[model samples]
Target: VSLSLALKGFGAWAPTIGWCAHQTQTCILLWAVSRLRPKLCWDKHRIKEMLSYGLGVSASGWVWYLKTLINPLIVGRFAGETAVGQIALAIRMLEVLSFAKAATYRISIAALAQLQSDGKRLKQAISEGMELQLLALGPILVLASWIGPIVFPLMFGEEWIPAMSIFPLLGVTYLTNAAFNLHCSTLYVLRRNWEVTAFHAAYVILFGILAFFLVPHSGIAGYAWAEVLSIVTYVVAHLSIHRLIGSPNYQIAAIWWAGFTIAMFSYQLGWWVVGGLGLAFLLPEARNRLTTYLKHFRALKTG
Candidate 1:
């Protein structure tokens, strides 16, 4: 609200100040809310433990900022803003598909945290979470595939038509990223930050090297593929590590993923409907776990 009003008032002459005004108002509101709720308390020992885990989480953020920044930095430096704009456009379009992924990442900790700290529960949560994410993300991607080409040019005009080439690969990247989110969250729940941190660092380094070669060769298309490839690497790394640590049947989600893709490309709603029913028989336990996860989320939300 403040942002919109400030942009209206000062945007014509000094647009940068608009965000500054908005941020000031936002901070004041946040401060007021914190005061009303009053969450923090002084406990030195507990604070010390919290700070250590918080720093691990904070370290992952720095790794992410660097990981996502490298390719665009390379693209902007070599290929110019037009390429940057196309990359941004493709990613922005893809972000819509991550809605369920983002929400699950944010909210499922409470449920997963409650599941008795046993192998069966942990494995159930991890594997079923993957299936639920596949179900959530796949239909939307298929739906978007039907409309995106037609909608892209109309929505943003013909200048962005070239970006459509990069769209599918970016969709794949976001699919892989959704899995990455769950794995990262699972790792956080399990207090396995050492390996997670190491993997993030390695991913960024490997992604930078791939981008160095890719962006120069195939322009934005190559860079998009690099992102996809690196994301696949992250997923594989997590799957392997997850298995080594505990969850043995992590690859089970691949069947659903393949089915979803095939049904999507086949463009068969009946097949999807049948597939939805089939999941109940094939993975009834998983369906139940997902139901429980959602009910837990709803309880948390309404509370």
Candidate 2:
């Protein structure tokens, strides 16, 4: 719907949509500002920092959004709308799965800000956060595999059948992206935004280059492959950043490997049973993480 609105050309809807984004940013800014007191606070400097962080987040989102449109536009025009529409549906699933990590970013930022023991606690938090994210999203990846085919066509119209075929593969792409998000949140909280941009730029470039050849030969599957490859590369770069900042708990490496293995094997299991069980395993982990996160949130509210 948002895509369709944008495609109708910005003349009719740009102002309206732009206003919606403005209102959202304004609300965030106001809320942030309200937390400050004029006499007690470093008002100007803090406001500048808040706005800068907001812009970084917003710009990152905008860049991805532009590419999101560009990729589909080319595919739809050159390859055929059915193929493009199908890929678009697949990408939409990716977006839905990816939102889970947005929460991870918020949580990581809070953790980094409050937890004073940066060396030990920061490492633990990053590990725990990744574990929490994996446990939360692992089964979702399974469910997407099981039901995406049926759901995609129903949601986007039957013209999206090819999209369904490639949908399961793209589920891994989302998983990789979630992992990348964890790395990003940790990095950003530690003040490594430039690294994030560089990591993404390199990954996006490589993925685009791969897609030029792969898309023609493999169609939507190629696109899925490109996404997974790029995200995995970004994840590696993030690990490098973690090391540069300082060693996080080395245990995080093992957990990441284990989580990836679980995700890989689980994807093979038929959606209903395998995905359902994976989610069941995820519940306790999620409960613990959510509880910890909420405690911090409440503390922040009061403090």
TM-score, prediction 1: 0.76
Task: Write model 2 residue lDDT over 1-303, tens digit each, in one string.
Answer: 345567777665866887787799988898798996446556798899988887776665555555575367545555666677678767776677767767766776776767534556766666666656665676676556667666766777776677666665676666656655556766666666656666766776777777776777777777777766666566555565567555554344344434443444343554344443445435665446557767977999999
Per-residue CA lDDT of candidate 1, range 134-247, in tens?
767876875676577788899999999878767767776666666556677777777766667777887787778888888988889878777767764575456644664565
Worst 10 contiguous positions by lDDT, candidate 2? 250-259
Q: Residue 226, candidate 1: how far off, in angstroms?
A: 0.5
TM-score of each: 0.76, 0.68
In order, what is each prediction's RMSD in angstroms?
Answer: 5.2, 6.3
For residue 80, give model 2's deviation from the true position in Å.
2.6
The regions of model 1 sitting more than 4 angstroms off are 1-36, 235-245, 259-303
| lDDT score for residue 216 of model 1 | 83
